[model samples]
Target: MNHDTSSEQYILVTGSGQVLAVSDTAQSLIPHISPLLPDLINGAGEDTVLLNGRTYQIHRHLLKSESGESYGLLISLQQTSAVQSSDPRLGAIALALSDKLEINHVLENVVRFAMDLLNADAGALPIYDPDTDRLLPGHLVNLPVDLIVPVIGQRRGLMWQIVHQGSSILIADYADHPAALPELVQVGVRSLLATPIIYGKTPLGILAMYRLRNEPFSESDRELLQAIARQTAIALQNARLYQRAIRNADERFALYQASIEIGATLDLEQLYQVIYRATTRLVSHQRFVIAIPTENRMVEYVHIVTPTGRQAPQQVPLHCGLAGYVLRFGVSLRLSGAQALPEPAVQLLPEIEGELADGSLLAAPLIVGDRIIGALLVWSNHHDAYTMADLNALELLAATVAVALHNAFRFAQIQSQAITDNLTGLANRRHFLQVLHQEMERNRRYHTPVSIAMIDVDHFKQINDTFGHIAGDYVLREIARRCRQQLRDVDVLARYGGEEFGLILPETTYEQALKATERLRTVLATTPIMIDGRQINPTISIGVASFHPTVYPDPSSLIADADRALYLAKQQGRNRVCGVQELTNDAQP
Candidate 1:
């Protein structure tokens, strides 16, 4: 294909390495490049070619689209002098740096490569950790690794000057320089040359070379180091991209499994634990919490876990901390350093014990439809301890949590309809049976006592006949409510049938069950339920049966024992409590 060769030499090829277009200058050298195309496409950099007895350097330039798609390749040629352009080792250094994918390995190799390029006795390339906003002295060649890495913000240093001036520093004798560390001088460092390694606007670190002998570095040495610095920047950036891609793949797989786990869990507390565990896989965090908004403009901490264990959950004002802030406004927050965080979030987290405010905190809102239900928060006790990738992972998990929470609430509503009495708001007979069987099984394992009480209203047919079924229905609902108020929370109360209620008092002895039943009879007989401008007194009789080690074989046999006691109570006197041994206690009717 024909191309614009008037301005410069350019040979454009398709992404598949096939020659597609050529500039006018490139047309004359087509035959020379045909053989080298395969190697050039496979990451080969530059080569020399003889055209008309004159030497030229042909560099491979990868042409990429705006979205980073490999659009094509451009082979550009330029005349090269006999003296050669820059050091040939720079190409080998770049190739070596690019060959490694691990970021730490790439950085370590870059330090040794820098020393080889500048011919220095020692070299150091300290990488910047964004989380701590500090340089880490991880990679060094013959230099002490314990030295605190110099940064641009730390004034009165050689790195600061190099970073600010955007030029290299060549020191002939570094024995008494103010910017030089006394420790370096004591370690036999006499000469030094340094340049900043930057990728775009971000300063990665300073590439420093040290010499034991006092040999001055020339301008050519500085130029060579700068060229290698540029190559180092490209290699570091590419390595980071490769590492990030790998982390993202692992995160996506983890999140996919999290979605399924969260969705299947009907228990809200279990779901919270699942979500918190899932988040730990995707982000580095010392603490994780789930908070929801309470009715009184307060944020309730339902789930809070730290490195030690769970922190006591409590409620705080809506403007108290980051969780409330994220839940209120439905926004994600990544907080670290002095960069402005909201006033309320910056406030010390007194409510969340063992959480330090000095570190970083990231929060994301759990939203379902247009409403923000709650927030998920992760905290680290170090400055700049989180990244954008961590926040993104949190947001994704929040979305999964939101959907799961919504489904759980909906499922609960439907399940309630299946197992709840509409009139009394108590467990229906079916649910009661299930609970009974479960409690019996638990007692078998724990060897705990179990007692069941059955109650029936006396003369209920007469009241329904006189006051109509509506009045009877109202009194039955009131009885259910009163029983629920008096019983322990562990007691399972249910509507057994019309005018009948069943109560399972687990972990209770025979005497304790009888006393509770007696109390129930007193409550119904002593207090008059006001209804329709009339005080209606509805008394009741109760029967108590304790599970025996040998007598009662199962839940069905236990129910039969309780029913026998109920018949005995009715025969002795209504408004009385009776047990399986025919022990009766009378209540004033």
Candidate 2:
């Protein structure tokens, strides 16, 4: 066969690795290729050979004599200035990619590099949506308007075709192409090229370049674009993986914080606050509501926190609204734009009329075991503001909230039971003493007066003898209820023992306590305890003692003084009130 060795460099080598012939340009590269002769002979197609710090593209061909008998191997060399220019930018991009840990930053850098490398009028890097099988525009440069690529039944656009076929595509007459977008044509795009950004066999996205001039992309341009796409795919994939790792770490930290902060307190209000603070870190919202289910299959808004303040909680029937939907179905709902919500859901949530006008809603069910306890609802004032990632985060946060709320409720119930009297539904003796001690300490610090009252039924034994013990129990309950009515909300009332009661009135003077006890004495005397159609009038003797730093230094001393006054009240007359000083003088020898 004939050969052209003048314009291009060529080398002929015998099978034994002896140089039989050489072109003028080949002589300079012979030294570099000789040391790697075995590798050059074994390697097929084009291989890069570096000679004296310069890169050369080498191609190998088999030389033959007549009758197809192989005589030797032929090699050619071409200098790589095009590749050299791209090397620096590619290296810079690699450095940029390695420096960035954020996915968005990496994507922006890729789009900028691609645009500058191609010198196109505009460019875009659209990420592949695996679920939709379409490209969602990620980063764009100098685009007049937003571009929305479409995916038809069997005819995805040129972009999808390039990804589907795993090849680079160049459309010189893009305006006339079948898969060209109308927007692309209107924007004066005459030529375009799209290269699939791929990681192994999986396609990540596409890097597309657009030119307003009617010029066809050459084979070299396609190759360069493919090279850029490959680099971008690796960088993008690395950034995505890194970001995913970071998100996972953040989520784990948030859950750990939730476990510690939410579980730190048994108070329901404090638990709600902790959940609010923790969830705000994951997602931003203006309104947060926790809806708990009632025994009657109804859902009640147990907690509602808003930017302004808290709102009064209200209840609705099951399956009535969005929150009800989550509670009834035990699933999550993320709705963006008012149009996304059904007519029935809108009508059910009339209270949130202002928020629904132009807001996005994310709701998730709070489930513990098989029981669906409540639902978490968060609302934002922007349309389509929440993503699937945000919904997933809310679900995770809802889990932590559910466990904490359940524990807090149980703790509250246990606390209530511990300090309450079973019969009269009043504070027990232990609770009274605890409160008295605390109140005395507080009074000492603030230099405020605290009063205590000791009361006994005037004729409790006679009432039990006359009526049955059941009636006596009824009388005691009635008396406790009346006493509670006369005391302030801050006052502490306890069932001291059988037929007796104790009261700790904080911020009260001696005279105020006496007058309050007198009112209780009169009320009990006037009110009759009715049992089985029998009216039995009951009265109570009362004693009052006010805190004096010198005289009543502690809770026990105050109680003792009040007891002395109570004996005086019994001695003087039943259904009366007496102070500690009055009792001391009356007992003077």
Candidate 3:
């Protein structure tokens, strides 16, 4: 039962409102202030002692230790104030009413009690809008229901100050507070109290009370209002959290429905569009891009869709962009806002038109067959706007989309295989002819030189006759594999028919073709075929033919020229490349 009378002006407690020791003066003043202790503690602002007809504002200080524990102090003012007659039982009644009410119910009663406690003719309880993150006076207890006051941005008034500063404001005279108007005073709100609704030190909102006459709020009234303000904080916190959860759940359900609709698509492009739409709908975004890897460890942006409903056909390289990093790292990259993005990322997306148009971006990797084949980048126009639920849902959708892409690729591969040689795993005769025609057309158009080589395994039929056809087949397969290993990726190797293979080399001349054919013949001669623990020597005869547009204009004629050279090699004891001249000179009628 002690108080600090050094200065009963401000209460700054850093600990949990505990008193360690008191001085003799504090102990002595304790007796005089004990009766009014509850009210003084509950008051919203500066402490004031009422004596005669004058008013004074007293300061109290409270402080919290570094460990977050709080302690209290009391100070007495040099001046004394007059008493403003009000209900003495109002504090106890407000507490009693709030004890029986839940968060919302208690908030309603608190607003009502605020009117009675402060002797206000009208009062209002503003709902804090979580979306706008502002206090909007939409609910009221006594004031006109249509008096909409927005407590956000520039419109932030007394209510905003209390919530933002986490402190209470007591206006003894409305005229003194710059924001107070004569209308508020005329409406019986001569004095005003704005107490912050706080939960665990964080401010949720403010509970404001007003009086009608040219009077100030009592210390006792402030004490009662503070308790009510704390209770209101709890209520608002619960209501806001409940509202957020409901909204998030509803959005998830919508995404779930859209996912089902999109799941029916077997096409990769369609699936990507579906995922993009669902993601943009559930979470706000301006642009979306998908980058898939091409040959040579390079990634190409195959799809780019904007929320503004525009699609671009140009592809982007994944070497210096955020999307590229996502593809390279195979992890999510969440940028806080556009400011957090790297300079290179901003510069690389310059052609994107509209600021790359988003503040937050989420990039997710698409993994299939133990490899990250691509990545999805989604952009949002708000900072830290995406939630854990949004990320989880996107990851699930990404998994599905990856599977769809894999299926599409497999279908394409199957279609390609329809014209491929299954035995030697090379292009079949039909595919070879089609490819030869295409290569010829390309050579003619570009005026690029090309060389064709027709190779035949020497005594292949004799090997099948001596050994079984299975051994012959094994030899053919091994030779095809060697030819593929020697040729560049651009070179085409095809099984022309039984025991015959043809290679179409682009960007090559006659001399290079002859040297390459000789190497092929030597490789087969040196590398022995191991079958059933038996090493069998294999050799090949090759015929080289160089395409000259004027000489061999047609693909069939070019192939025949190479075939005739191969026949000449066979006549001259196979296992050598017979150039075109060898065939013409050796053919004597």
Q: Please tell me which predicted candidate would have the highest TM-score against the true structure.
A: 1
User: Per-residue lDDT tens digits of candidate 1, residues 1-589?
Assistant: 3323233478888866678898776786666445445544554555544333234566788788899998888887775542233567766775576466577887788778777767789987767665555566757888766765534235446765665676788888898787788879889998888888787666767788888986877788888888777766656655665566567668889999998888888887788789888988888888888998977999899899978888778888888777877877889988764454675444446448344546788889999989888999888887667888889888988998998988876787899999999999999999988998888888778989889998999989998998899999999999998989899989999999999889999999889999988988898899899987999999998888887656666778788778878888899888888888774332100
- lDDT tens per residue, model 2, 28-79: 6665456556556666666654344344567888888889998899887765
TM-score on alpha carbons, each prediction? 0.73, 0.63, 0.44
In model 1, how large is the Cα lDDT of residue 188?
95
Q: Rank the candidates by TM-score, best first.
A: 1, 2, 3
The global Cα lDDT (0 to 1) of model 3 is 0.67
In terms of TM-score, how similar is model 2 to the real structure? 0.63
User: Across residues 1-589, which tens digit of lDDT does each residue of candidate 3 receive?
Assistant: 3322333333222233333454443444343333344444545555433212123354665545698765465544433321223445543543344233134665677688677766665556666555446676645665556555564456456777776677777778777677876556445566777677676665556677766666778777677677666545544543444444455556668667765866677666676677677766666777777778777766677778765675654555657577667776787766654566754443446444225434667777889878887787777666555656567666766776677677777776886698788899898888878878887888889988788999898888888987799999988999999889988988889999999998988888888888888888888888899988888888999888888777776888888988999988989999889888676643211
Which model is ahead, 1 or 2, in terms of TM-score? 1
Error of 3 at 266 (Å): 2.5
- List the global CA lDDT of all models: 0.77, 0.77, 0.67
Q: List the residue pairs that clash in candidate 1.
A: 5-24, 131-384
- Could you tell me how far off, in angstroms, the CA of residue 490 lies in candidate 3 after the best superposition? 23
Which residue pairs in candidate 2 have backbone atoms (N, alpha carbon, C) closer than 3 angstroms, thus clashing? none
Better of 2 and 3 by lDDT: 2
Q: How does model 1 score by TM-score?
A: 0.73
Worst 10 residues of 1 by lDDT: 580-589
